[model samples]
Target: MTVTVDEKRCIACGMCAYAAPEVFRIVGSASTVVAQPEGKSPRVRDAANGCPVNAIRVEG
Candidate 1:
């Protein structure tokens, strides 16, 4: 799976990081992908869904 964050859309709310610490984190003014797991992770999906501004995207 591949995970990405849209810098323009990110608001540094930290919800993505809070939802999936292993895959996302708050860096400076945005959320970034810290690790890309080999497969689909529930936490990753949750993080994406939890993003208030819909900055997180997940693809397989």
Candidate 2:
């Protein structure tokens, strides 16, 4: 799966990192993709859904 974070919309809430630490991390004032999993990950989806600003995007 491919995971991406919209830094412009990110608020550094850390929800993505909390939901999928393996795929995301808080960097500076936004969330960044730390790892791209090989396939669709439930945690990634959760992270996307949990993002208050909807900055996380997951695609397969």
Candidate 3:
């Protein structure tokens, strides 16, 4: 699985980073995930769902 972040929809809440620091980080004022490491999709997706603004996406 792969994850994608809709930067435009982000609210800088930092929930994703808090939920999964290894997969997500605060870049400037938004959250982002390193989606190319092969086995982090579930963590990223969980982070996304944990976001209050719903700013993340997961794709297989």
> Against the true structure, what is each candidate's TM-score?
0.92, 0.93, 0.75
Off by over 4 Å in 3: 35-37
Candidate 1 at residue 45, lDDT? 92
RMSD of 2: 0.8
The per-residue C-alpha lDDT of model 1 at residue 2 equals 96
- Top-down lDDT ranking: 1, 2, 3
How accurate locally, in lDDT, is each candidate?
Answer: 0.88, 0.86, 0.74
Go through the candidates in order and give the clash count of each: 0, 0, 0
Winner on lDDT between 2 and 3 is 2
- Candidate 1 achieves a global lDDT of 0.88
lDDT of 1 by residue, 17-49 (tens): 888888888899998898897787988898888
In candidate 2, list every pair of residues with a backbone clash.
Answer: none
Q: Which model is ahead, 1 or 3, in terms of TM-score?
A: 1
The predictions' CA RMSDs to the true structure, in order, are 0.8, 0.8, 1.9
**lDDT agreement of model 2 with the native:** 0.86
